[model samples]
Target: MTTLLPPASTTPAPGGGACAAAATPAAAATRRPVVGSVHSWDLSTGVDGPGTRFVTFLSGCPLTCLYCHNPDTWRMRDGKRTTAADVVAEAGKYTRFIAAAGGGATVSGGEPLLQPVFTGELLHRFKHELGLHTALDTSGFLGVRATDALLRDTDLVLLDIKSWDRATYRKVTGRPLDPTLDFARRLADLDKEVHVRFVLVPGLTDAPDNIAGVAAFAATLGNVSRVDVLPFHKLGEAKWQALGRTFALHDTPCPTPEQVTSAKGVFETHGLYAV
Candidate 1:
């Protein structure tokens, strides 16, 4: 979730002339415009979306979450500059398989909304052209960037709400909490389908009040169809080490299954289906 932009490097032409510049910009404009900075792509099941999925992990994020597993995705320049057409072409390969299994495409991130135009175009292609269900996995930090056109094509949104309290949210992710809240409200107003994901860390986000607060807020939003109370783990510790960053929860224990169940109970108490 850390938003870090590494300096970009430009490769000069061998002849070192204006002709090189012309070839680059003109060709780029003619193509999909290189809007989606891609980190990676993969196939997932029973997780990102309804059934199976082709997940696109884009680059760049606004919030620096302490538990971010893919710290390498923080820098936009580090990702491959890809176009929507190429993305759809790749997804099209498994279109029949995904459709048969009641699955579709999911654009996850660093923050897919960081490149709204690219994400929008990709989703549009999947929904309109390929006849596929489209989902966006986001932190809701850049929710304002989700234009109506984009939302129109997205069938589901996997919004990761880090924390409920503003102070605690800021502490967990080096960003304000309001933007995510505002985005959630927007999704509700649009009546968009949403699956809320909340991680339960033993010492950080496991406070009873914090869990209750998130549950209360989610209950207010009628669009929320499900709550995923995930247990914290050290899965991302290696990534942090590789990045030469401090892994804050190194010694913190993960939430016990009982604790996870209790957190889910809070959401159920609010009459929302939670797991």
Candidate 2:
């Protein structure tokens, strides 16, 4: 629940060169772009799909969601240095198993868009080289300029909509909601497949009206594949303490199953499929 804003100045890699030459045929097949930082990878968390899917937890995020589960990933300099080729080589080992189980690599983080060049390269290699499914878990706060070519190779977009109301969104994420909504609309317009996710945080984002509003907005989009209502939990409380950060939702309890069900119902009522 710690709410630490990202530093004002983030140093992106110069000229945005390729991290390294794709050594293998799989790597050579994809055009990998150069990026600033090669943070760490998360071999844990099997949430991407079936099989043993590898996850790359990139550094940096723009949003300050009060109930973020991975506070440790907020900083832009916390993990080890690695390049796109490094990640691809590591993930390539389990490509066969992942593909057989309908699973592949998932790029998650404080916000993958913060390192768009690196993310795009990873997706390119996953598709053109390894021929594996690629998914991006983002907050949708990134602007149109940052998402242009990146969306072309992404198979699935896990778009997290913090709140429906503009004012409420600012309160929850410490950023304007318009950019996020615009990004979602652009994804829908481009016919990109997306899964709209909303975190149901009690006393903050679980309001009935807000849920209904988000559903209504999603109904206007043509490429919405599903809506996922994630119940709030204190999974990252300890991380906040370890980081010496103050938790914002210290007294907030986890949402009940009924609450999650009700929120899902709202999306269903709006003609958008909810999961």
Candidate 3:
């Protein structure tokens, strides 16, 4: 299961930008234009990225995935307004802890690219000020927003490739798949380190052709270091219900171990590392 820690309290920074001081009151009222809508954060190990991570959950997503656990993050307005300085201040508190564990900061979503400026600034500070590695967890729906300048600061990308077929992609996530494919190609061109994620839903995304398509695509990207085939689960049913939304996969079974192994086999067959 993904470990979720309590939300980190934020304080305003002395200033804005990548060189801002890491001291500010936690109760500051003003919101910077480059600020992000933050939902929550967690300190996790062996999941989000390499080593332990101080994962910041920035709110505002463009895609509406069927199995999104944190449905509360769907909207752009329902989150704490925080500047890059505030995030850096909060993450600074654990600098030593994170470094000791060989982990860094991961800017996850709702989609981090939705708030490109804030995400970029936060990434810059995390790497320059704190001397930490940076990773971005995104579906690439808004990948166009990830400018070359912003991507220059990012060390790795946890790219989620939902499906291979365009129709099935639209069904799983209320968005097209070509943009993600384009983003993947761009990242490959830039030689960015990427860990590709694909969730294996039993009835929706477990088709042999879909798996092969994704794996074949990944194999073509020399920058893709690993492929993570995640199993679908009903862990977010309650969240959907609490939000007064229909949970479409109530009867959808989780992929069995054999199914997961088979999916992994697809990636392996393409000469890509899978887990």
**Winner by lDDT between candidate 3 and candidate 1:** 3
Which sections of candidate 1 miss by over 4 Å? 1-34
Compared with the true structure, the alpha-carbon lDDT of candidate 1 equals: 0.83
Q: Kindly list the per-residue Cα lDDT of model 3 for residues 201-248, writing each as its tens digit.
A: 988999999999999999999999999999998888898999999999
Alpha-carbon lDDT of model 2: 0.75
In candidate 3, stretches whose alpha carbon ends up further than 4 angstroms from where it belongs are 1-33
Decreasing lDDT order of the candidates: 3, 1, 2
The candidate that achieves the highest lDDT relative to the unseen native structure: 3
**Per-residue lDDT tens digits of candidate 2, residues 217-255?**
988998887888888889888988898888899999898
Return the candidate ranking by TM-score, descending: 3, 1, 2
Tell me which of candidates 1 and 2 scores higher on TM-score. 1
- Candidate 2 residue 49 Cα shift, in angstroms, is 5.6
Q: Is candidate 2 or 3 superior in lDDT?
A: 3
